[model samples]
Target: MQDAILDVKNLSIRYNGASEDAVRGVSFTLGRERLGIVGESGSGKSTVGRALLRLLPGARVTADRLRFEDVDLLDLSEREMLKVRGRRMSMILQDPKFSLNPIQRVGAQVAETYLRHFPANKAEARAKTLEMLAAVRIRDPERVHDLYPHEISGGMGQRVMIAMMLLADPDLVIADEPTSALDVTVRLQVLNILDGLVRDRGIGLIMISHDLNLVRNFCDRVLIMYAGRVVETLDARDMDAAEHPYTRGLLAAQPRIGGTRGPLAVLDRRPEWKEGSTP
Candidate 1:
């Protein structure tokens, strides 16, 4: 059996005054490998990712077990959590514009992140930040460092955000829609960078996304979710062999390039309708 890096059992999350849990009875395990979660909007995929980082305070999260590196995440105090976050575990937000501070120089912000976890001098921190920038394939690291968030392109801003997250040398990275904002060509480039990071650093990754095709190509395993519940899980390479109706529907909805589908099969939404629900 693979060594478990993260084990989440029967995890559930409920927002204040919500009729039901946002995440319902979710359980999964991660080794030192890449795992992908795919679903439509409001599917609780992002909620599961955020809950692992303890990022949602107003949302109640409970689990029979939520352990990272054999430590119970629920039991840690805020101070203790600070030591673990960004050092051993980190997250990349969906949008760089909101994730990054608009006023801070890119280089200084990244350098500060490095210094927070590493006992380094200012010069050392600056050097490390520049190295990380180069590692992410950014050209002119020096000039880019001095520029504010608005001065860079969306793709470059994303790379800067990634550089900051890696500053702490985290073993696990949860990337939530890391390439959602990029154009098709740029999206592939960003995914390539992420692929390199996982392969070269042996960092465990939980990539949360709504794009089935992207996850199938970029990840090792895939979990398909619907309405806050995971309905299917399979090998990414074998996603074509998925058995669930919902999974099959998602695959059928994709438009093929060379040919036209006769009917363009519509997903059967009736299964989602409950006794009193009108959706």
Candidate 2:
């Protein structure tokens, strides 16, 4: 895409002492679009997300070209990368329990991002925090602001986490199974909030998830990964047209409510699929 904000080409990553790369030759470009990456456990979904932000401390992350906007992400110094994180880019982690500070009040933690990137006073930061909390559809932002992380419900915590990451108006947002811990209603609510941000704010989104149905209905494009590589890429509405055997197997494995009453399909892994796919 000519308007691409992120370009990743020939990317591969391997942890120290590992014989093979955990993520092998992953390549894709992100415009102001919602791109979904779906795969089973250990298929390098989250690994790819962390690799982009250079969060894999012990892993060797390599790419021929990994550029975010005008900057080369792979070549940046850690100190320089820190400037990009939160201000230019943000990551909404999987669970609120782990992502949020247990002891910090909700408002202070959300306000920290605003204070870190901008020259803002405490009162200004608090206003922005409360505004963002309300923006995410939280009721009674003033009361929730002073509450500790442990004081909120799981669904509310997800909203607070979204607010904290988005408080600075980042250009790119990486959500790693962001709603895995929520119920059906809360999941849709959180997804709607993300959809609005991508639509209204024009921020590029990469949603790393295992739920095919979620990505099918939510994302614009879908990347199907198997054995640490993207096996197929297609429009989310065209998942049924996937050509890869692994992709087909995944589609077959998901049980439908009113469809067949027979047993769900089991994936038959093949070693040939371990090789990297051509871009």
Candidate 3:
């Protein structure tokens, strides 16, 4: 963590009227590397990412240390945080169908993002926007730029989302299941774009996903969450050697290609596992 971009220690969160904490004692430090957060739905994977950007409106969030680069996230006002978002930090949401503006052309949405962050003319912003679209491997940036969100395929819309978020060259990116809507081929292509970002731009990336195999192969480090807590942390390559029962159960639960003809193993819930788990 010599040049860490994000640091969170003992981070916990609860909803407005939750009976207990939804996320508790989750902590990790991120450098210029791809870190994956994997868990089943409702495990708080998305919640932690939202908490970093103060996107969770009525949730109670407490952390001993929540620092993005040199700025303290908890101390920033809404207006102050706006300068950080879409400029220094950005979140690539899961679905473009809901995330993108249905009425506007994809190019204008991306160009508007660039204009908001950088003081540039419309022509200059459009040029930058096209560059980003092409960077994500869109075949015809000029043609697709004019299409509305409804006119594009899910995978194409996702690429547009990526193009928009990356327009400003943010220091850190939180990608929540970025490839869920894409096909196998498109998913790999999108992942390659993100991989290029980490390797070439040297930016920190947090990939939030429930697909263990995807994280294992794509990310450098892995954090396995269970019941809103990080039950284990390990290098991506060492996922098979994970010690936590929850992690092992998750691995065992993955269906192999032509290997498992029987039902997948079910994860047994244990009370002790949730009481004191930490990464």
lDDT (Cα, 0-100) at 251 in candidate 1: 92
Q: What is the lDDT of residue 153 in candidate 2?
A: 87
The C-alpha lDDT values of all candidates are: 0.88, 0.91, 0.91
lDDT by residue (tens digit), candidate 1, 1-279: 278889999898998789988888788999888999998899899999989999998888999999999679989888999988988999988888888899999999899888899889999999999999998999899999899999998899889988888878888999999999888888888889888977789899999999988999999999888887788889999999988777888899888788585777678865662122223
- How many backbone collisions does model 3 have? 0
| Clash tally, candidates in order | 0, 0, 0
In terms of TM-score, which candidate is stronger, 1 or 2?
2
- Cα deviation in Å at residue 237, candidate 1? 0.5
lDDT of 3 by residue, 75-128 (tens): 899999999998889999988899999999999999988999889999999999
lDDT of 1 at 273: 27
Candidate 1: C-alpha lDDT: 0.88
TM-score of each: 0.95, 0.97, 0.97
- The lDDT, on a scale of 0 to 1, for candidate 2 is 0.91
Worst 10 residues of 1 by lDDT: 270-279
Candidate 1 regions exceeding 4 Å error are 270-279
